[model samples]
Structure formats: C-alpha cells, structure tokens
Target: MKTFYKYAAFAAASLAGLCACSSDDDAAETGSGLQAVAQPQIIVSDLTTSGFTLRWEAVDDAGSYVYTFDGGSETPTTDCRLEFNSLERQKEYVVAVKACPRDPAEYTESPFTYIHVLTDDLEQLPQPKITLGSAYASKTVISWTEVPEAELYEFSVDGGEAATTRNRTVILSKLDKGRTYSFSVRAMTSDATRFTNSEAAQLSFVTSDADVPPLVIAPTTIISDAVAFDIYASSDETYYYEILPATTFAKYSPEELMTAFQTYIVEYAKKQGISLQLAMASMLKSGTQSLQMTGLTPELSYVIFAFGMDLRGNITSNLSSTQFKTTADGYSAGPNYGGSDWFTQRFYISNAYLAMTGYGWTNSVWTHWKGDDVTDVRYRTLTTKLFNQVFPDPYDRQAVAAFLKDPNYGLQFNPALLSATVNSADGYNGLTEGVSAGTSYTLLTLATSSSGAETVCVNSVTTKTSTEAAAWFAAAA
Candidate 1:
C-alpha cells in the first residue's frame, strides 16, 4: 500500500512538471534578440517542511545562474546547486532556474528547468522515540530521537501540567532526592497545534542520594608579563574559572557573578557537578594550564575567579578570586652618536649637549651644565635651520615616509648635502665662546658627514639680547 502511494505521488509531480514546461516554453521563445540557451537537467535532492535543494548540470560558457522559488525574488549564483528557504510549510511550489552569460551585452539565458515540490505537512509529523538516561541526587535526564517536521517537545511529569521545550533532551532538576518520578514526552509542531503522538511516551526514574560539592584551591603564582596560576580540585569532577581586568571586576561583584554562573549551569547540565567538572577541565587545559592568561597588555592589573563541582551533583557555593599587577616598562642606556649632515634633520638638543646637561645621554660629556636649558635656542632652533640650509634640494620625502613606516629600510641620504671642517691646537678654527668688538658672539658648529668624517667650526652670530649671548657662551664653556 505504501509503495502504491509513493508511485502515485511521483506520477502526479511528473504530470505537473510537463504542464509547467509547456506554458513557460512560449515565454522563453518570445524574447527579441535573446536566443534561448540549453535547458538544464534539474534534480530535487533534499526537501523539508519549509525549504528544498535544487541542482543542475553546469552549462558551458555560462558565467552565472538565476533561480526563482514559486515566482518569488530571483537570486543569482555561480554554482549549480541552490537552496530555497523560508518557504510556506506543507504547500507546493514551482521552482525554476536558468543559466546566463556574465556580461549583459552578451547575455543569452537558457529556458528555465523547473520542478514541483511539496513541503512536509505539519499534521503528519513523525513520532519521537524517547530514551531515559541516569538520574542524579536532584536531577533526571531524558532524550528523544528528533522528528524532522517537529520544532518542539511537550513534556509532563507525574500527570502535572505539560511543559514545552525546543531541545531534543531535557534534564529535570531540583527534584526531591531519593524520590521516584514518572515522565512522558511527545513531539510538537512549530505552530503548537498538532502533535506527532496522541499518547505521550512514559518512563520512571529515582533520584540519587545526597552528594558533596567540589573544592577549588587558591592560585599559586601570578606573573607580571605572563599572567598564570595553579588550581587544585578536591575531586576529579569538573570546574570553571574566569579572569578579567580589575576594571571589569569592579563592575561585577563576586556574588552576582556566582549567581549568573550557577543559573547557566543548572540550565545546561544534567548534574551541576558534572557540568562544572567538564568546564574546569576545559578551562585549565586551554586558558590557565598553558597561558594562565594570554594576550594580556603589559603593565596592567587583573583579577581571576573560579568555581567547581564534586563527584556528586553539587556546585561550590562561594567563588575564589585573586588579583595581581603586570610589570612596568624599563628603558636601558646606549651609545650616543651625533647626527649626519647628509640628513637634513638634527637632534633638537644635541646628544653631546644633552649628555653634558645630565639629560640621560650615555656620553661622558655630561659633566658641564648638568641640568640647564641655556642652550635651548642652539639645540632646538639654530641647529635645525642650519642643517636644513645644507640641503638646498630638499631630501626625498617619499624615502623618508617609507623609512618612517619601516625602520629596517635601507635609508640613504643625499651625499651632496654634507660638508665638514676640523680645527687643530696650532691654529684652531673652533672656539668655545668668541666675542667680537661689537659684542656679537661666535656659534660652535658640530657636523658629521656620510663618510664618517666630522668637522668643528665657530661661526659668528648676533644675539637678540646680550644675556642670550652670555648664556650661549657659558653653555659652550
């Protein structure tokens, strides 16, 4: 009898497909210059209560394909397979697809290959086979094989009011321990109207005896650069822990977090202890066991909290927490080599001058003017202006941009911008602080060239104020 019904349904669908093709053929041939391409071989692979899959042979020279489910919005795709979703449940649809060229100017579409498909009826949903699992001290787990057309399950305990759920399995919690309870379950349609079974499946179970909660020990060590810690469980049961910055912990109190965590565990676990055990194993294995904490920004503070479960189904009532600070940054000193004339920029404050003024420069010249801003004009103003004047043709800004982007770039400055001169004790060209008869001052010049050659010169300058001239001379001295 079932075989006869299956063949009759196939014959009806075939007849409907022929009629749909006959009507659509006229529409396919009526276009102006758009020649009809090859018809695709369509196959209906999968079907559900609200959707179906359609596949066809790939057409030669075709760039993309278009498909329509029951004359709805046309969707384009490059693949041969397409899935139609959100369809009207338990209704028949005339789905079609066609191939076309990529360019609109050269586009020529094939006559659509179509099929007739009927979604599974909600009233005819298949019955679910219920299975009972182990029961805990205050909980019992029940599961059912899924019915393809059912969206929810109707469950009841000991003739009580029916409860609805979208899950295939449910764990009844907070039940009286050592007490026996009867349970029944059935598949329900999405609309909540029709059910797969008129009579619900029945089963009985007894809760286990009382159990103890697992204990979690405090962490051993929390490092600065790498935050890590050790956690010990009372039993092999599961546990969970969370680490957050002090700023985040400040917003969520430990009590509030514990409540939320237990709520989630009760909803998902068969036994709270089992869920905690699994969570602890995963957290310690992935988060704490390896990194303790990974990707933590340096020089920051953080706090961590953890909860666990024992051999039975109990959860740790109180959460344990620990807080620590990351290490601070340190700057080490290095050699100070003066700037080159080939480069159009200068040290706003020369390393030699900075060293002499106790500005953290590594050079021994830091003995003079150990802490003074007397040479600010010479370091920040005249030095840059004089250095820039040496490069009449501006330095390559593009090269400078690349150098700024990546320090490892082979940075080379124009050699023509450099010049140097040296003075000797016999007749020195450089002087500490020279004053002309008119009260003008002499400026000391320190320029290093690209070839590693350095020069010293004393150029004359007129200061805006006599005090400024005296300051410059005093710094040079």
Candidate 2:
C-alpha cells in the first residue's frame, strides 16, 4: 500500500511542473502584444540659395528616429529637424528617415521616407578664362573656356548681350573707321541663377583707314590659267580698287614693300591696340595684264591702269586703263576661266549645240553619237551620207547644217573630209569610199550649182585618176 502512494505523489509533481510552463508562455505572449512601434514622416523645408533644412514628424511609440542626408551616415535629431548648409548648386539631394522601436526585445523600424533639396547658387559655376587669337583691323576673334553647368554665355561688346551663347568664342566685326571697341563676358547657370559678371577683357580694334592697302594673294604670280587668285579685303567693310603707278611697282624694292606693309599694319594696329594680319589684295584683270590697286574707300570711284614689272626692276608703262566703283558692301569674285579664246569658243559651241539638241556634249564628244555602239547606227549612216555629198565641196554653211542634222550620218565623216586634200596624191580619190565621197560630191554640186558644179565634178574625177596612178606607182616601187 505504501509503494502505491509513492507512485501517485510522483505523478502529481510532474503535472504541476507542466502547468507552470504553460502559464509562463501565455504571460510572455500577452506582454509582446501590449508593446507598440512608431513610424516617422520626413519633410523638406527652407529651400534657399545656400542650402535647405529638413524636418520630420516623430513617432510617439518609437524610441528614436534616425535621419540621413543623401544616403550618408545616420544622425539622431530629437526635434526631428536639422539644418544642412553649403549644398551644391543645381543639384538634387535626398533626405531619408527611419523610426526605431524603444523595446530592446521588440526592436523594429518603420519604412524610410525621403525629402529632396535644391540650391540656386551661381558661385559653383567655373570662372571664365578668355583667349584672344587672330586680330585684324576692324575685327577680332575672341575665345574663352566654357563655364561648367552654364546654360548660355552672356557676351558684351562694351557692355551688353549683343553676342551671347554656349560658344566660347565670337568674332567681333564692323567697327568704326580708326576707332576701337572693348569686349566683356559672363555666364548664366540656370533660369534663376547667374554668376557675377567677369571683368571686362579689353580687345580694342580700329577700323582700317581708306589709304590702307588691301591684302595681296600669296605667291603673287598666278601661273595657272585655270585658277584665278582671290582678292579678299581685310574686313567686310567697303573698299575700292585703283591702279598703282607702273613706276611704283618698279621703284618699290623688297625692303620698301616690307616697310610699306609693316607701316600700314602697325598704324592700323596702334589705332586699335590690336594685332592685324593682312588677309588678301583685290585687283582687276583685263586680257593678260592686271591693274594694281590705286585707292580704296567706301563708295569710291577709281581708275585701274594695267602694267607689268620685270624682276630686274624694269617697269612697263600702263598698257590700258579701266574704271570701277568700290562696292558698298564686301563682294567675292565669281569663278572665271581667264578668257582663254579657244576654250571660250569651245564652250560657246558646246552650249549652242546643247541648246539645239537638248543634250550637252560630254568632254568635247557628242553624247548621242559616241563610241562604237550600234545604237547610233542612224547617226553613222547620216554622217556618212552627208560626208559623201560634201566632199570636194565648196564651203556651204546651210549645207553643212543640213548634213549635220541628217539622220543618216555620223562623226566618221569628219575624219574623211579632213583627209580630202586637193594637194595630196590621192586628192579626192578616197572620198568615194562609202557615203563620205558621195556626200562630198553632193555638197560640192549644191554649193557651186549648174556649170560650176559640172566643173567641180570634172576636176574631182581627174584628181581621182591621178591619185590612183600615184598609189599604184608607190605600191609597185
């Protein structure tokens, strides 16, 4: 009976222990359910040219909220707001916030919130650096380094936006005669912010005087008949051409020429305080001779005298004289062929034929009747017939035109006709082969008429017999 009592007591102890463990678990669950977590809201405020401030609503149930600027290290702010300074210009920044729970056992954070900041400070733009290159009388080219984050450059001639752009350089042109002008520059970063204007960079340039000589084309001598030298004025300003005296060309030694050029350039530069490089000279050409410049000014009239100078300092007197007006505005010469008579005649003939035939000749050869192609068989036949009718013939323009337009002939007739010489041993003997001779005879008959045509026929026959005899003798020998 005692042993049975002992077993019952042990069972009761085990049951109590299990009940205690279950109660402890229930209590823990209830405690966890009572604890609360907090969420934080971020807001951006006080946007300024320098920087921006950020603020947030703190969560009541949270232990602390951490804020970060642009994904940087987190910082703790009790009032949920902080002021950040010295922000970059025209740049975007993100502020992030996260809430942390107070309970050590139940540590959890709310979702992160973001705030953006922008600054409008212009000091962040790069400083302007100016470079002056290639200055001439009445004009100067100025280049500058580009400013970072700048949308457009504000250029001032004297002090204005008359010339402004992203282009680092601009050409200043058209200044008063013998007067100088100053230039300055600045940059615009954004629609709202513009950097302080840079100090004025002085580029003074004077307009060339009326007496200043124009630029001369290089190598002086234009040897190629196909290429004509350009006579460009230093500027787009109005200028005229005048014939320099023949004596001037002969009297001016190399040193004199150099001195003259340098003196003029220096005078122009000193007036403007800017460098000037001679660009080119303007001259008029007539026949094979050219007239040197005599005078140049706006809307001025001048006479040009043609003259030549030998390297030995011998000058040819003025060969001819012509007058021209200085154009009101700058002008460029049109392409010219130097007036080659033969070339001009050839061009005229080509153009006239093209107008008549509706097709231009290609490289001196008629396009429609070219090469050995059979497509021009009609042309060949026409030409042959025409040549046959014209050989041993007198000159007849109408007959020649008719023969050319005839549908049965080609260019082969040209060679045949050219080969027909009365002084030759063959005379008109070979002219009878194919239509060449026949056309020559017909042309001769038409040109001389009746009795004259009959006489020509007899002469042609006699010439043919003589040619045959000559050929036989030569072959026999």
Candidate 3:
C-alpha cells in the first residue's frame, strides 16, 4: 500500500509540471491565436440580513467559477455557485463572477458578469447619551454610556471629521483657550451600516483663560539707620510682602515667594496699631502712613515685593519685586548732605554719641576705642569703615561752625537720652582724633526731622585696630 501511494504521488507531480509548460505555450500565443472565454450569467438568491448566495449558468468546457461580492473574498466553485455569510446589514454590494477552462493547462479566465444586491435593513439603533467631562485651558474630555449592540462610536467636534473609537471616553485637544466649542457623538452597529445620532446630546463648553498679572511698585527711600520706606498701593487688594538679598532673590520660585510673602504680611500686620482689617486694607491701598517699614540693615541690597489679588483670593501677577539699595554713610550720598563732607563727619560723632549715651566710658568701652578720656584727654580713636560725605571746600570750616552751634551738638556725648545718667553730673565722653580706615555706614540717631521723620545720615570712615589706635589720637603719646 505504501508503494502504491508513492507511485501515485510521482505521477501527480509530473502531470502538474506538464500543465505548467503547456500554459506557458498558450501565453506565447497571446498575440497569435488565443481566444477569450465568454462572460457568465449570474443569479442572486437567499438574501438575508447577514449574507446572500450567488449562482451562474455553467459554460461549455469550464471547470470552475470565481465569484466575489463588493470585491470581497474570491470564491472558487466547480458547480457554478457560491455563497457569502456573516455580512453587514442594510448595505448595497456588487457581485462579479467569471468562468475558467476545464483543461489543466488553461490559464485564461472569462470576463466577469456583474450584479447588484442589498442586504436586508435592520431596526434603527437608539442614540447614546453623550456628556462633557473635564475642561482645561486648552482641552476637554467627552464621554458616553456604552450603547446596546454598538460595536463602535463616532465622536466629532465643531463639525469636523469624525473619529471612530471602541472606548466610552475621548479627549479632545488643541482647543483655543478661553473659547467656546461644541462636541457630539453617535452610535453604530457592528457593520457600521446602521447608525443613529442624538442631536440633543451635543455639548457646548468654554476652556479656562490664561492668567494676567497687575502692576505694583517697590520701596526706594532710606530714612533711618534702620532703613524705612513707604509702600504705595492703588486698590483694595491684599498686597503681599517679600524681602530677600538681591543676590539670591531671583533664585526663588514664584510659588515659593508667594507663600513666603503671605507669611510676611501676617507677621508684619500683627505688630501694627490699627485693626487687622485696616492694616490689610491700608496695604491694599497706597499713600497712607500705615505702610512704613523700619529696622533694616544699611549698605545692603534688598528686593521688595508687591502683587495683585485675584477674585479667588489667590496671588496673581506675582512677578513684582523691585530692587533697591539702602543708604549708608560714605556708601551713598543723601539729599541732606548738600555734597558736604561735614554730613559724613557729623554722622560719626552723632551716631557714636547716641549709641554710647547710656553706657559710661568703662575700661572695656575705653579700650575698645583704644583711649582713656582722663589720660588721653584731647582725643579718642574710632575704628570704623569710611563714611565721608563730599564737602564744599571753602564752607567746610563754616559747616563745622554750624554743626557745633546746634543745641543737640553735644547731645550724643551726653547721657541725656536715658534717665539713669545726667549731662550735668556724668558730663561727656569727650573728643575724637579722627577715623583711621573708613567705609560707609548709615547712622540712626535719636534726632527727628522738623516734619517728625527720623533723621537718616550717611558717612564714610577708616577703622583701626587698637595697635594702630595711637596714630589717630593727639594725646596718645
């Protein structure tokens, strides 16, 4: 039995090879004498919602027929018949059929016979309920409940091309910010031939708008040893406060600075004499004396803060930090100096006199200045940074005469500011030789201007070690 099967397989292979060669000869006769087969007559029947059957009359010498519906599967049938099932409902299709020769070597195919047919329509589908979801600055999400018998859904926006998805939710992106838009969705059957739309299900929504900030100004004037300035406001918006060295101020993130500023406003308002409401309102409005800040160091760079409030009470337009440098004697000249170096000279004597007023000249304080008042009667050495105000040359002597004549001229040397010490009994911590190595320093004094503003003065000086103190004083030797 095995030997017989083997012999049969050999014969089949040889016959196939011969048929291939004969077909090649027929192709060679293509311009010579080859004839075409006749087109077949097709009959359609057994039409159903899912599929249909097709039949064709047998042609002479034909071995099989090739049939297809709407360019679908090419079916081979020796009995001149074919059927297609599991198709879409309510859809039109064209069926085409052709005949092939019975001879194994024949390669020619007959011209196709075309016919039209329609699958039975199905019941109209029910529309799905569409809804709008999250809306952002430039995008939004849409969703719908799954519809019965739905294989897919069509989502559309602004009458644009539809996108098909099996998902119940879809995100629409690239929308214009702060603009209104419309979106809709519809359900379709498995074949997509039966579809229904819910016109009432359309949704309209607006995207969120971008943030825009308001204008604000920072502090610029220095009025005392502890630098003070007025912050102006325009409206009843809560203004935040921020203070940081100019060097590192820019490094702070916007959100971080905002948080810190809130803390500053709360803490600062706690120390004011007015009610919280008034303090906050004053900060929100400008030109009131309520916003004067003091107790800052001199010769330092600082960045001040201001910003507008939003309807939600959140910080907005938060990029409002103005940079300013405090006025220090010798470091910077103030309006009162009149370009006279006497202002600088007066700053030192006046500043030291006020700071040392209540404290007597003890061994420690005397040694710090490197001079004993009784022994070194004519002079004292003040070692400090240079704080020199530019002075008019001819009037330098006259400015000196004016400064000595003032009633408060010797007040710093007196202990008058404190009740424990009296100028009549304690006398004065007299004299000063001069500065050794000088730089700028802002001098805060007990003196007040005529308008009641604290007097802020600037001057430059040279600081000296006790070892170098002898060279500054006339009586040190």
- Arrange candidates by lDDT, descending: 1, 3, 2
Each candidate: RMSD: 29.1, 31.2, 34.2
Clashing pairs in 1: 214-310, 237-277, 238-276, 238-277, 239-276, 239-277, 239-280, 355-366, 356-366, 357-370
Worst 10 residues of 1 by lDDT: 468-477
Per-prediction TM-score to the true structure, in the order listed? 0.27, 0.21, 0.24
Better of 1 and 2 by lDDT: 1
* Model 3 lDDT tens row, 227-304: 233344445544555467787787877677777765555566677655555555555543322343444556777776
Model 1 misplacement above 4 A: 1-36, 72-75, 102-108, 122-477
Model 3 CA deviation exceeding 4 Å by range: 1-238, 263-301, 309-317, 324-431, 436-477
* Candidate closer to the true structure by lDDT (higher is better), 2 or 3: 3
Q: On residues 148-214, what C-alpha lDDT tens digit does candidate 2 reach at each position?
A: 4457877777655566687665665665556656677765555333332333345544544542233
| Worst 10 contiguous positions by lDDT, candidate 2 | 468-477
Which residue segments of model 2 deviate by more than 4 Å?
1-122, 134-137, 190-477
- The local distance difference test score of model 1 is 0.47
